[model samples]
Target: MDVKNKVVIVTGAGSGIGKAIAIHFAKHGAKVVVSDINLESAQKVVDEIVTNFGEALPIKANVAVFKEVENLVQHTVANFGKLDVIVNNAGIGPHLLRTHESTLRDWDRVISVNQTGVFYCMKVALQQFLEQGYGNIVNIASLAGLKASPNNISYSASKFAVVGMTKSAAMEYATKNIRINAVCPGYTESALLTQLINAKPEMDAILKSVIPMKRYGKAEEIADAVVWLASENTKFITGQTITLDGGTSL
Candidate 1:
């Protein structure tokens, strides 16, 4: 009952960590808005939530588009009556390639979604939050945002920007009852990771060797952190990046 009756919006919620986060909030009595680029996938999550007797709404939206993000917020407020939490969970990882080999298009694509998209969502959500006088934003950044990531130039750069944006925006709204924070997940168990491991079978061992815990973090684990951040229990916490890497960054 931590978030009971709260209206939550989760982007890229069709699958992976986004999906898990949406479900977690619903279970805790939140009215979730499942937004994703894939309409079918978003509807599936909505169907599941509805089947479970939880309130949910599905919307197909690409966060990269500011107009689309605006509509997303408007739609959520129309359906749910208000917006309490906005989880900027929609993001993409660029292909693993050395900086020199990566093209301008590659960098642009990653930045458009991972970096600029977050800004669009945050800006629109902040507008709504300011009017309401209260809001919570939990951006899903990566551990790579904290450190250098070889062969992932664009992704690293974009995520680093996300981290900086989170901190700066958090400070701007810190005293306004609007809390903005981020979660830096290391190697997490998800469909994307599965594809990565499948492409390079040796990555399995490499990950275990690098991560001190010898395991990847679960989607649900990250979801737990996100839900906690969205709750009022951490009212004193803001502008913080919770790293859930299991000592990998160390």
Candidate 2:
């Protein structure tokens, strides 16, 4: 639970919140497995961690593919001997579009990656956790999971499913020493949000005004919350979604 020298796996760790989480955990003396769909990106992070004297292994894995997820777990345990924590952070947000204009293709794509992908990772990790009799999982959901957002129907739906799945799994393993939880980030300062802000400069002011904090969250800030949830600091915490939205949901 201390996570010091614990074997941890973080998906989508090539960039953004996932990357920060991986780095943070490594900095705290945890052996991290950095996984992503993009091998190059994951390798970059892994290299940085190594340079900083942290332990890490970069693996190319697309969480949407079940076999790849299984491989991810298999390889981690093979290398580290056991897995203590897993962060299901790989996800895609659908392009902003009204439901009337959104296609079934769009729905499938979002659901497959955001929803089904989480399931695959959880299922595989859960098996290992059960065998070890202890494990922790932190899923990166979204504010959309807690509140409906127009023009993001697909994304919202998928995240809502993640929240539900987290709770259900937590209950199933509560007595088994497996803790499952989610982190819902709202309008964080990440590559995705930066692209949107750059495209519509005016929307920047609007985004800031909506949040009570009058600013976007830093990736490291969300990383802090995640690390805490994954650490022994919150052993009693489980089946909960910690929202890091700068008080936007409030």
Q: Scored by CA lDDT, what does every candidate get?
A: 0.94, 0.93
Q: How high is each candidate's TM-score? A: 0.98, 0.97
Q: Name the Cα RMSD for model 2.
A: 1.1
Worst 10 residues of 2 by lDDT: 191-200
C-alpha-based local distance difference test score of model 1: 0.94
lDDT of 1 by residue, 1-250 (tens): 3899999999999999999999999999999999999999999999999999999999989999999999999999998778999999998877788999998998999999999999999999999999999999999999999998898899999999999999999999998999999999999998768877887899999988999999999999999999999997898999999999999999
Tell how far residue 244 is off in model 1, in angstroms: 0.6
* lDDT tens digits, residue span 115-227, model 2: 99999999999999999999999999999999988888989999999999999999999999999999999999888787767767898999899999999999999889888
Question: By lDDT, who's the top model here?
Answer: 1
